[model samples]
Target: MEVVVNRQDRRKRRLVRLFLRLLLISLVFAAACAVGLLSYTKMQGPPPLNVTQTTVYYGADQSIIGEHHQGENRHWLPISSIDTEVIEATLAVEDRKFYSHFGFDPTRIGAAVLANLKTGSKSQGASTITQQYARNLYLSHDKTWKRKWNELLYSLRLEMNYDKDQILEGYLNTVYYGHGAYGIEAAAQHYFGKTAEQLNLAEASMLAGIPKGPSYYSPLFDLERAKKRQGVVLQSMVATGYLNQIEADEAHLEELTFVQNELDQPSTIGPYFQDTVEKELIQTIGIDQALFEAGGLKIYTTLDPQMQKEAEKWVASEMPDSELQTALVAIDPRTGDVKALVGGKDYTESPYNRATEAKRQPGSSFKPFLYYAALENGYTAATTLLSEETTFTIDEGRGSWSPSNFNDNYADDFITLLQATAFSDNIYAVKTHLLLGTDKLVEVAERVGVESKLKNHPSLALGTSGVSPFEMARAYSAFANGGKRVEPRLIRKIVDSEGEVLFEAEPEMTQVLDPKLAFIMTDLMTGMFDPYLNAHTSVTGGSVSHLVSRPIAGKSGSTSSDSWMVGFTPQLVTSVWVGYDKGNLQKPAEGQIAKRIWAQFTEGALKGQLKKEFPVPAGVVGVKMNPENGLLATEDCPTHRVSYFVEGTEPTKPCPPPAADGQPETEVIDEATKEKENLINRLFRWLGN
Candidate 1:
C-alpha cells in the first residue's frame, strides 16, 4: 500500500512538471512573435507601394493609341473585379488558409521546413499569398535566410496596413503567370483573351497553376506540362472544399480554348507610328530603362488618328506587292505636327521605319530648293534660263560637266524660270545652281531643314545626295507656311498619373527665306500641275489628278533606285517615297506610282476639312510674261502666261514684237552649243552604224 501511494505521488508530480514546461515554451514563443511584430511594424511602411501600371498614349483627338506595361505586363484589378472562380482556385492552390492567416502561415512553413530537410535542398516553398506578395514587392528571389527574413517582415507590415481583401488582390495582381503575363487580369487576357472578371472555372484553374512554376509549365513552351499542372490545381480546389470531385473533374477535362494574347497580335492602328512614339518616349523621359517602361506616363501626341489610319490603309491597299516598299509622312504645316506617318505596307512584315530612317536621293523633288536659292539671288520667275544640252569644260585635263534634259529634246532658248520648273528641266536647274554658287544652295537646304549632309558639287542640283522623307517634308514645310521651318514633332506633351504635366513641347520655328520669295516658289511649283503650263508633263493632271481639289503644289522625283512625290497645301505638308530597301528598282512598271500615291493620300486626308488657300504674302506681285521670253507680255507674244515675281524682281521692259512671219529669230551657235550639237549628231551616227 505504501509503494503504490509513492508511485502515484511521483506520477502526479511529473505530470505537473510537464504542464509547466509546455506553458514556459508557449510564453517564450509568444514573446519571440511579439518581438518580430514590433520590428515589422517599425519597418518604414514597405518601401512605398511601387505598383507599376500601364502607360497610356493618347492621340490629338484624345483616343487611346496604346498601353504599354514595362516588364510586368500587368493591369491591376480589385478583388471585387476578379471572378469568384479565379479567387477560389487561387486560394485552393496558393493558400487555402489565406483568409485565416495574418501574414505568415506557420503550418505551411513548418511543413515546408520538414520537406526541405528531407531533400537537403530548399526547393520546397511555403510562402502564403501575402508572403509571396511581400517577396515580389520588396525582396529578391535569392534563396537565403536574409531574404526570407525581409520577406517575413514585409509580409507582416502588409497585413498590418491593408485589409485581407486588399492583401489578396495585390498578391493576385502581382504574381507572375507564364509568357510574360503578370496579375490575374493579364493572365486571363494572355491565356483566354478575356478579363479576370470574364474567366470561367476551367481557365481559372489553369491560370491558378502558373504562378507556382511560371516558366516550367508555360502553355506557350510546354502544353502537356501546363495541362498536368492545371489538373493538380483542379484537384487542390476539390480537396480544399471549394469544388466537388465531379465539378473538379469536369473543369479538368474541359477542352481549353486559349485565345491569342492581344499584345502578341499586330496593332490595328498605326503600329509604326506607335513604335516611333515609344522611341520618342524613351528619349523624352531619360530615366532608368525599367522606370521608363514602368513610368505609367500619359503621352499626348500630334498624331491625327484618322489620317494615320488612312495613310496606312492607302499604303497597304495601293502597294500590295511586297517586293516594292513605300513610306509616307504628313505634317501640319502651321504646327509642325506629324499628323500621319506610315513607314511600310505592313508593320508586322517589316518595321524598318523607312520614313524616318531610309535615306535615298530626292531626285527632282530637290529642284525647289535650287529655285528658292535662285529667287533669293537676283533671279525671278520671269528670268529666262537655257534648258539645252550643254557642257562645261570646267577641267580640260580631268573632265567636263554636261547636264541633259529629261527628254532628249531641249526647250526653247527663252524658256522662263517658271517654265523650266514646269518641265523639270535638269539643264535649267544646273545652270541656276552654277549661277548661284553650289555652296549657296547647300546653305539654303540646311536652313530649310535638311538634317542630312548635302553636297556642294554640280550634281547636287540634280539631288544626287540622299535625304529622308522626314527631312523632305520638313524642308517643304518652309514653302507651305510662309518660309518658316517648323521642326517636325512626334509628341506634344507628357503628363504623369497625378495629372501633372511633366513635359511640354514648344513649337520650334525659324524664318529661312523671304515670305514673298517662298510664295513665288510656290507659284512656280503650281505649274507642275497645270497641263497648259507644263505641256511636257503635268504630274497632277495625270491619271490621279482628279484626287486634288484644292490649290496645292508639289514635285515628283525619280531615280534609278528611288521614287518620290513630295507635296503640300497651305495647311499640310507630306512626303511619299517608293523604292527597294536596297538596290535599284529595275522592274518596268508604271512611272506614276509615286504621283498616284501622293494624290490619293492628299485627297483622303484633306477630305471634310475647310479648303485653305495659300495666302500670297505681301511684296509678291503678279505679271503676265511671254512663255517664250522673260519680258512683259503683249498681245503679239505667243502663249502669254501669268507668273509671280517678287516686287522688285519683275522686268520693266516690254517684250519685243513677233517676227513678221510670227517665227523665232535664228541665233548664232556658241562653242558650247556646237559641242552639244556635235555630241548629239555623233550619238545618232553611232546608232545608225
Candidate 2:
C-alpha cells in the first residue's frame, strides 16, 4: 500500500510539472502575439506622411517640359494613371499570388526553404509583391532575420490597410529598376521612351523582370540575359493564367523593341548634365524623407533633348579613340542658362564630369581678362609695347622665379599691343600683367566669373590657375553679353508635383566691365583671329568670316596637356576641353579632337539662327592700321589691316615713313611718289583726327 501511494505521488508531481511548462509556453506565445499586433497597429496607422514637390521643367519657349520626384530617383505616375494591363502584367510575372497573400506566402516560403535545402544554398525570395513594397517603404534590404521579420510584419500591415490596387501602386512607384531609375514611370521612360500606360505586353514583361536584379538583367548592359529573364516572366504569366500559352509564347518570341524618345531615353540624355542637375536639385529641394524611402521621383530637368542628342553624337564621333576625354558646356549668354552639357565620353566608364568638376589650366584663355584689365586701365589698342624677349625675377625671400613665353622669344624689337595679343605672346602677356598689376588682373578675372583660386603671381597670366569649363564659359559670356556677367544656371525653375513653383532661377546679371571696355576687348579678340593681324592664325579665313554676321569672339587655349576653346556667338557661349583623365600630356593626335568637336558642334548649333554680329557699343570705333605696326595708316596700308579704339584713344599721330638707315629718310619725288604721298598724308590725317 505504501509503495503504490509513492508511485501515484511521483506521477502526480510529474503531471503537475508538465502542466506548468505547457502554461508557460502558452503565455510566451500570447505575449509574442500581443507584441506583433501592437507593431502591426503602429505600421497601419497612416501611409508615411510625405511632401514631394515634383520638379517642373520648362522648354526654351517656357512651355511645360516634364516633371520629376525627389524620392524615387525617377518620375512617378499614380497607379490609376497607368494602364490596367501594365499593372496586371507586372503582378502576373512578379508575384502571381500577390493579391491573395498576407505579405508572406507560406507555401512559397516552404518551397523556397526546400529548394535552398536541396541546393545547399539560398536562391529564391519568399516575399510577395506586397512584402517588396513594405521592404521598400519601411524596411531595408538587409539580409538579416530582424530585417526579414520587419519586412514580413509591415507587409501584412500594408495589405490590411490598403487594397490590392493601392499596394500595387505603391510597389510600382517604389521599386528600383537600375540605371539610376527608381520606379515604373522612370523605367518606362528611361528604357522605352514611353509611359507605363503605353507599354506593350513584351516591354512590360521585360521591365517587370528587371526588378529582380536590374544590373543582372539590364537590357542596356546585356540584352541576351535580359531577354532570357523576360522569357521567364512571360512563362510565369502564362502559368499564372494571366496569358494563354500561345499568347505568352508569341509575346516572348516578339522582338523586344524599345523606342527611345530624345527626351525620355536615357541613352540620348547627357549623363553629366543629369548628374549636375541632380546635385543642384538636391541643394534646391531637400529630399523628402518619405518619398526617398518609397523610391520614385519625377525629375524634370533643364536639358534640351535635341541639343543633348547632338552633343552626344558629336562626342562619340569626334572624340579620339585614345583614353583622353572631352567635355563641353554651352549656355545662353543672355539668361545664363545651360542649354547643353557633355561631361565625358561615357558616364558608366567614368563618372568624372569635366564640365563642372575638373579644374584644368585655361592656358592662353586667361589672356583675355588680362587684356581687358589693360583696356580698363586706359591702355589703348595702339599702345606700343616691346615684345622683345624679357625675364623677371620673383623676389621670393629664398629664390627667384623667371617666366618665359611658350615661343621663348621676346617682343623687345617692337610689337603693337594688338599684335602681341593676337599672337598670344607669353612674354607680352606677362609684361602686361606686371604693368597692370597682378592684383587688378585677378580682380577682373574674379568679376568675370573665374571662381578658381588665382594667385597674385605672373604665371597666372598664362592660365596656370586651375579653372573649370563652366566657369570659363561664364566668364566668356561677359564678352558675349556686352560686359554684363551672367552667372551660369543649370535649373530654370522648380515646381512641385502639383505644378506649383518651388523655385526659379532669377538670373543675376552684373556689369563686370564697362560696355566700352567690353567692346574694345571684343574688337581685340576679333583681330586676334584675322590672318592679316596674327601671323600665326589659329583659325582659318572661312571660320573667321563665318563669325562676321554675328559679332562672334573666341579664344583658343592650350596648356601642357590640355586644350581648350572658349568662344561665343551673339546668342551662345561654348567652352570645350580635351585632356587625359590622369592629367597626362595628350599626344598630338588627341589634342586636335577638341578643336574639331568645337567647330562641328558650333556649325550645327547655329544652323537656323540669323547671323547677328555682336553689337558694337557707342564708344567703340574701328580704324585702319599697319599690320606690322599698330599705328594710324595711309591708303598704302593693307585694307584688311584694322585695330579697335575707344573714340578718345585713337592714334593722334601718323606713323613715320619707313627709314632706310638710323636717320629718317626723305621720299624721292617721282610720278608714283607724288600721287601716293598726297593720298597717304590725307589718309593719316583723317585717321588721326
TM-score of each model, in listed order: 0.77, 0.68
List of clashing residue pairs for candidate 1: none
TM-score of 2: 0.68
Best by TM-score: 1
Angstrom error of the Cα, residue 383, model 1: value is 1.0
Candidate 2 error regions (>4 Å): 1-44, 47-75, 84-165, 171-193, 199-268, 282-295, 305-325, 343-346, 393-412, 494-502, 534-551, 580-593, 638-642, 652-689
lDDT of 1 by residue, 1-689 (tens): 99999999999999999999998999999988888776757565644567786676788899877667766677777789999999999998888888898888899899989999999998988898988998878778998878888888888888877889988888888898876677888788788878899989998998988888888877767779988999999899889988899998899889888777334442466777878887876765463567656655678888888988888767766774657888899999888999988888777789889998889999899999998887766567766656667886543347788777665667656567777777788888887777667888899889999989987788889899999998999999999999999978888888875577877887788888889889889888877887766544443334555679988888888788998899999878989999988888866453467777888889889898888878888767787876656677776555667787766656666777766787744355673564345335433432342
lDDT of 2 by residue, 1-689 (tens): 99999999999999999999999998999889967775765666745614232343454545434444544455557787886656767777778777676667889889988988898776667878988888877777876668877877777677667788878887887788887677787788778878888888888888989988988998888889999998888887887777888888888888866554233323335667867776776655565545433333334455666666677778899786778888999988888888889889988898889999999988888889998887766566765555545557554555555666655655454556677666777777877787667898899999988888988887888998889999998999898888999977777665555445556666779987888778778777766456666444333223434433445567777877788877778788889998887866646656556666776677667777887777778867877776455567764433336666777667655556656564323334553354344335434543464
Candidate 1's displacement at residue 263, Å, is 6.9
RMSD for all candidates, in order, please.
8.3, 9.4
Clashes of each: 0, 23
